[model samples]
Target: MSVTAPAPKRIELSLPALHPEQERILRESSRFNVIRAGRRFGKSTLGRHVLMNAALQMAPVAWVAPTYKRLTPQWREICATLNPVIARRSEEEKHIDLIGHGGEIDFWSCDGGGFPGEGRKYKLIVCDEVAMLGSDLERIWTRSLRPCLTDLQGGAWFLSTSKAASSYFTQMYSWGQGERPEWKSWQMRTADNPYILPSEIAAAKQDLPAAAFLQEFEGDAVSFSGSVFTNLEQAIVDAPLPEQYERWAQQRSWMAPETEFFIGCDWAGAGRRAGGDFTAFVTMAKDGTICAIERFKADFALQRVRLAGLVSRFRPAAVLAEENSIGAPMLSALRASGISVQGWTATNATKHKAVEALALGFEEGRVKIYDVENRAVLLAELMSFEATSLPNGMTRFAAPSGGHDDLVVACFLAYLASHRPRVGECAWSPI
Candidate 1:
């Protein structure tokens, strides 16, 4: 009698239900897929499900993000799906192996001055938020991960909302739009997702500057030429204002006995209703998170009263106000009210250095800001601000003609106060 052989068990694999827009992209047979979608469009959910489906093909796949911190949440979701089929999990390496010859999954970051997953082959690559990868965008693709796909003739998917219109991501998008037959691209807005509220998007359009509204909510990569900031999407968070934690801080202050917050003020010299300049006050956490912003055109007395209200609410340790022109009177007023206020004078050189520092704060991911309604003006000013190199080798930073930088200066002072050096980096010295 001959012995019978058992067949391999069939492992059922199904993709999570996708919205029509997401499903449409996967239906294509293109070797490269690029998607530009607005915030809250469920790009992560779509990416997670697609990667899970790809795992069934028995070939290694990689997921890359701008930073490891941003990759954590998505990694958690992917791990949960692979848990049932996991053969092994390496938390330190962030790799997952499947039991049914489902190959493996790896996660990597584009930062730290190296190509992610160098010398590793993959059957598929997913680069999320390609726009945030910064100046390394060209080198990362041409010299690194793109070559790793040759062994298996693997495919890639790139996704981002677009930062600069001239960004390298834009070049890849052009390739998808008939420049390269092997590539395909699609653009979707917040409204594309049936789940997002139309009212919310409409409100954002009203609040955000025109260019910002287009890029962030409509998936258009509008160029903010010479803008002092990069990676605004990463810096602007949805955290609650400091006032929300007022009670908690009050209770905890007795235990820690340390300062929790600081404030930076830029005076507009009673420009309210006169249309000359606007005043800006920024309340910043000790760690550089901009907890709240108050921008208005008000007289000196009213401004102090408002500033005092903020001081009482957050109980900031100090208020650093610009110590020139109208700023002098504002500082004196706040000081007279028993508020701990300091005055910092801004020369062109010092101001430029401070602005540069704030820019770096955004680039290095050291800064975060609350995305409140009043924040739109500040974002607009930062994005539209220009940088000019002077003959003396000093860089000149200023807002576009007829635009306002009151908030930008306030933010610079806040960042300067937050990162004030006790020993190193005295270029940001405030007098």
Candidate 2:
């Protein structure tokens, strides 16, 4: 008797339920799907659904974010969601193999300056927060990832809130709606999400600047004119420390204990209310190297505890907190914790001095920052800062409407503290 071979076990795959808007966009027959949505409009969730569903059909799918660090959370979620149907997962390569679909979803970062989906055929590609990927986004799509889709006739989806009207994201959105016959687009606000409260949006509108409200909540690409700092990109040390710094620092290991650390603090409002400003702490070395930065929104008392912990870890020579509003209390609280904290009053003159110093640092290549792609808000603030000239010939520096400069201010403080003279330092020149 001849025995027949057993059939392969069927693996059930189901797409996650999506919101009505998400479903509508997915239903579009266009090869390109573009969405310009307000913040909190469920863009990430929709992207997840799109990638997962695509994997069930024709794949390997590709998900691209501005940076690897930003893509990490989504990568974890995708792995967890498809764990049951996953055949293998390569964390090192950020690749996943499905059980029965012959499908894989790989995550890539645009910040690495390489073609993400090169040489690989993809059935679907999702670019989350494409606006933050910078100006070369068009080349990334048309030159790099688009060719990968040719073999499978795969589709591409672009998702982001408006960054600027002149940005590649807005151009793509326009092309998707009109210029491209194979594309479709959708624009929606946070209000469209029934899960969000109307009062919350109203409060946001009131709190945010007019242009910021329009861009962030109204899905408009407002122009960024009169920006103060322009050389942020040139100053960013995206990868490891530069070889020059490494060599010099390695030669100076004899003075490790003498190297003073500085901390700059920007205290958030009390009550730790939702949507409040952040308490940013920037730590730097005496040599003007930014070591680390942390931002939090919590109660003043709680923040002090956190500060104390950081103080012990950093062993800062001096902690400078902005001496305004809740900052005064926070500085005192930190000092009471036996930390060497000081209050730095933020008057117009002092703020102007600090801001100019920071701008000069970036311009002169004296200050260096890391994790530019991951720490987006900080980088954005540094780039979007603007200075206005008053009728009296005075200049006021601040972040554009709807943006926070807490990180920038904290960084400025760190930079300022880095130059302070240490005890037993000579006042006369060595020469």
Candidate 3:
């Protein structure tokens, strides 16, 4: 009896095709590979292709994003291509047990509970939209996911767009820039995706804002519009101070001082419920260098105590508190505490002017900071700053929606009020 020929082995593979960048990222075998590109540039598509291949090889892969909603669309795309049978299954049957047996893909968001439980370990973990993940999630990734891969001889693949230059994705980019023992990077723009239609790209460029076009389509690190301090890297220094260095912080007391100092304040009212702005206190030396900076939320007694503490700690020459709702009360409180304080009102002077002055200091390399924390907050706020004009023919400087500018506003006020030579004044005036 002739035996029927065994049915041809079924090879299940899910991927349209591999592009050059995808090939490089997949074949490198590095411990880390950062895939940075613009939106709709096939970043997720390439990520799915690599993950599916790894899973087919019996490598347990984990896919994650900032949230479940962000990962769902790509999860559906991957499911349709890799496991049509599973995809067609009813939602009730989509549980992990049913999918795991069929070599199906499992997706999750970067929430507290999304991490794998005790039983299973992932061989490869792919993090998408990495920029949006919180710092706590990053800690989980390094502490949990990285170690799991060690036993499986696997690596992680990071896929994301170029978010803010100070975001987690940028941090990864910085790490990849160095020669790591096991890591690599692959960057590309929307133009790199051959499959994307040119007409579509042109349409996007026409419809999107200039900043959005550069960041999402061209993959350029363009700064946000109307930023008060555009060049923060130049304004802030990260170098360590010399052991023998001596300056303002050393020979200063809050009681009184021979050298004059200017106090810059950004007052916030309506208490914490208002969520409008912060109460900031900044003390700058006459030479334009920052001596002391203090920031706190909108609290009456707490802010007063903090301001009093600052005055008693570093005797400022004059306090310039913003003349907003809280300014009057704050000034009164400082006065009651025996602190020298004054109210400074922001006038028709455009936000651009103040920012330009700060930018000039940065360009001249005159701006310096004693601590890095305030500098970081200031940089972030500077990046988010924007200019807007009111209906009454007045322009104002403000932070972008959902942005923080407490430190920046304080810094700007300090820069504006700090002592500067008159436009035509000379150091050696003729008697």
Candidate 4:
């Protein structure tokens, strides 16, 4: 008689049932949903539960986190929840059975190679600690994951603790905050997790720094203490194009005759990636008000020439262009072409002092920015700006990774070069 194959066994998860908030998330069918909760609040536990449910229901799922190194513990925790029969299989064999049976979860990390090609369509995706993922991760989800989910009636789930108020995570939170038919949001604090002991909360409060306690335990988006620009929200204005420029110009025109105009230039190179960013040429009058300006963001030389033309028309009192690498070449080319430009050495002292001065100016409401298409990028950088203390006890503002401070740097240089106490008489120019 021929031997027969043993039947495959079904594995049941031994975890507790979902809580009210967890059940709410499970019932949600929105295309996008975010779960903002503190640690030990059952966010990841609920995520794993949902993944198992999707698997049992014959839905493909992907579990993504910031990095594989950080995801190992989660994987082990999830595996521990699995029945012994499934957990005993070799890793490779286990994946095969999981996919074939339709009760499986695949792991992905933002730092890993692109999405897996497992020959199975994915119906659900769970992103953990989303705040720690790089901004480009959003593009990955939009470009690759979104299209892959087309046939599965799939949805993406995001779980993260609150981050700085302007980070990628915060932006997603804001996006989900709006009334949209396709999105849902749920938030909870450490206090909401009954599993956490009261003594644990008190201990965290006593041990962790104030900002850390507020962020991790309270789920609050508080700026770090010692931040130079603590009241950054007030500095932001929602002025849209041409109108913002016109209004700013009118304001500058009202200044005294002796007021000097300063233009700060941060040049971009000649490569495609480089061309994507403009040669940011920002103009500011002596009263710390931004006046006329040009941002040459496109690739063609004609755009640069047009930008140069705008500079000529503005006739700023002084043009301070950074003279390193591509910037030096661009400045030389512009000056050679009769653009009366002055090269400002970006020494360590000058750069440091410039940023400090700009911080003071911003605090004092002496600086203004014209409304433009690039305001979002500039504002994000400004809001995320942090101050680091040196051994000499000096604090310097710098952008965090995934952040851009080119405009901020240019503005600082402009302020440093033109800053002077308001005198009785100032020259005013119309551009």
TM-score of each: 0.58, 0.54, 0.50, 0.49
Candidate 4: pairs in clash = 256-426, 257-426, 257-427, 257-428, 258-426, 258-427, 259-426, 259-427
Candidate with the larger TM-score of 2 and 3: 2
Cα lDDT listed for each candidate:
0.74, 0.74, 0.61, 0.62
Q: Candidate 1: what lDDT?
A: 0.74
Lowest-lDDT window of 10 residues in candidate 3? 422-431
- Where is model 2 more than 4 Å wrong at Cα? 7-14, 224-431
Residue 212, candidate 3: Cα error in Å is 3.3
lDDT of 4 by residue, 1-431 (tens): 99888886565547778776677667863788887777777788888777766766766677777777767777777666664534233454224125355656777666653444434468888888776664544665677667767888787888877654345566666667776667777777887777789899998776554555566877776644345443445555556433434444334454444345677766655221254555666677666666644555655355447646555555455667777656666666676666655566665566656765666667656676656556666666667776553322233456765555567666666676576443322222222
Worst 10 residues of 1 by lDDT: 422-431
Off by over 4 Å in 3: 1-8, 11-14, 27-29, 84-104, 112-119, 207-209, 222-431
Model 3 C-alpha lDDT per residue in residues 219-244, reported as the tens digit of each score:
66554446444445655546643222
Between prediction 1 and prediction 4, which has the larger TM-score?
1
lDDT of 2 at 86: 87
Report the alpha-carbon TM-score of model 1 versus the true structure. Answer: 0.58
Itemize residue pairs with steric clashes in candidate 1: none
Best-fitting candidate, scored by TM-score: 1
Model 1: residues >4 Å from true position, as ranges?
A: 225-320, 323-397, 400-431
